[model samples]
Target: MRRLMQIACAVAAWASLSLPLSAAPTEPENCPGLIASRDALVSRAALRQDEVGLTFVGHATFLIETPQGVRIATDYSDGTRPPVPPDVATMNKAHSTHFSYRPDPGIKHVLKGWNPAGGPAYHDLTVQDVRIRNVSTNIRSSGGGTEYDGNSIFVFETSQLCIAHLGHLHHTLAPEHLKKLGRIDVLLVPVDGGYTLETFDMMEVLRSINASLMIPMHFFGPSTLNRFLSSAREHFPVEFSNTAAITLSRAALPKSPKILVLPGH
Candidate 1:
C-alpha cells in the first residue's frame, strides 16, 4: 500500500503540471568557475571549440564541436541562436520546431530529408570524423496535406555516441528503425507523452536504444515531466538537478544508465 501511495502522489503531481507553453525553458546561465555556454547553443569558439563536451540547447538542437574545429548545429528554431556560428547545420522536413529552412543561411552542408525519394532510403552525413545519419519516420498525414516527415537520427562516430532525435515522432520504432539506430549513447526525446505516442510506446522506444543518457524534450508541462520520471524511475534512476545546465565530458560518463531531465531552450 505504501508503494501504491507513492504512485498516487506522483500521479497527482503529473495531473497538476499539464498547463501550456508561453516561453522557452532555461536554467540560470551563470555558474562560477564552470564553463557556461551563453545559451544552450554556443559558437565553436565558446568551448574553445573543444571536441568533446556536448551542450543541449533544447528540443532536437545540440551543439557539437570537435577538437579539430568542426562544429555542427542541429534543428535550430526561431529564437534559438548559437553564441558563435557553426561549421554545419542539420534541419528536417518535420514541423516548425524540427526545421525552419527560412531561418538557416550560410551553412556548409545541409542534409535534406530522412530518406531518399524512394522507399528504404538512407541519408549518410559524414563530416571530417563526425557522422549524422537519417532514418525515415512514418509520420504521415492524409492527402488532406498531412505528411510523413522522414526524421533523421544522428550519430557522432568520433565520440562513439549515437544520438537519436525523435523529431516529432508519431509512432513506435519499427525493427528497421531499431537496427539502424544501433548502440546509442544519448537520446534526445519528447515527453508530451501522448502527442508523440502513448507513454508506454515512447518508453519502449527509449528502452530499445538503451542510451546512457536520456534527455527529455518537447514536454507539455510539469505533469508531463512527472509522468516521464515516474515511468523511467522503475527502470532507471531519474536524476533531477536543480542545476541550470550540465556539461558532459567523455571521461565523466556514468557507469549505470541515467536519465537527465534538463530544461528546454
Candidate 2:
C-alpha cells in the first residue's frame, strides 16, 4: 500500500509538469527555465520526430547527435574524445577528468561550466538545429568546501526531446533547480554514490525529475553501477544495452520512466 501511494503521487506530479513545445520548438538564446503549455503540447500524446543518437564516449562524456546533424559532447575532457570532433562541447570544472585545459581549436563551441573568476557560468544558444543551455549548480571543491556554481546541468533540445546532463553533481537539487530544468524527457546522471549524490539522494533526484529515460554515467566500475541499478529498479524499469549508443525519438519514449544502462567504451 505504501509503494502504491508513492507511485500515485509520482504520477500526479508527472501530470502537473508542463510539457515541451508542440510545434518545432524554438531555439531560444536561453532556456526560459519555466514550463509553458500550448495547444500542440497539450493535444499531442506523442510528438512525431526524428531520432537523436547518443554515444557514451567513456567516463562522463556522451556524444549527442541531432537529427539535423549537429553533434554535442557533454563533459568533454582530454581522457576521451568522440571519434569525430563535436560541433559543440560542454565541460564542467569538477575535476581534471571533466575538463581540458587545452581544447581542440577546431571545435566551434567550447562551453565551460564555471567562470574563471568564480561567478556562475551561463550559456544559452542555438547551433544549427539544436538548442543548448545550462543551469548552474555548486560542487565540492578540492579543499573540501562548497564551490558555488562550479558545475552545470546542461540541457539539449532537439527532435522534440529535452535532454539534460547532470555534471558531477555533489548535492541534492533545490526547488529552484527543478523549476529551471522544466520537463526533461531524458536525463544523463552521475551514478557514483560517493563522488556524486549518494544512492538515496540520487533516487530522490530521479523521482523529482520524473524523466522518461534515465541514463547512468560516471560510475567507476560494475559494482557501483550495479548498486545504483538495484536501488533504482524499485521505482523505474531497468534496461541494459550491450552497445554504447542508442537512438531515441520523442514518439518512442517509454510511457513509464525507464533506466537505460549503456556500456561504456
- Top of the candidates by TM-score: 2
Off by over 4 Å in 1: 1-51, 79-81, 115-121, 142-149, 241-245
CA error at residue 115 for candidate 1, angstroms: 5.6
Error of 1 at 26 (Å): 40
- Reference-based lDDT, each prediction: 0.56, 0.75
Report RMSD (Å) for each prediction in the order shown. 12.6, 10.6
Off by over 4 Å in 2: 1-49
Model 1 lDDT per residue over 73-175, tens place? 6666554535555677666655667665465567677655454464533556567756656666765553434356456555554443455566667778887
Model 1 gets an lDDT of 0.56
Estimate, for each residue in 106-223, the C-alpha lDDT of model 2 and write its tens digit.
8899999888886898887789767788889999988999999999999988777788999999988898888777788889989989988999999999999999889899998899
TM-score of each: 0.72, 0.82
Error of 2 at 72 (Å): 0.5
Query: Which candidate wins on lDDT?
Result: 2
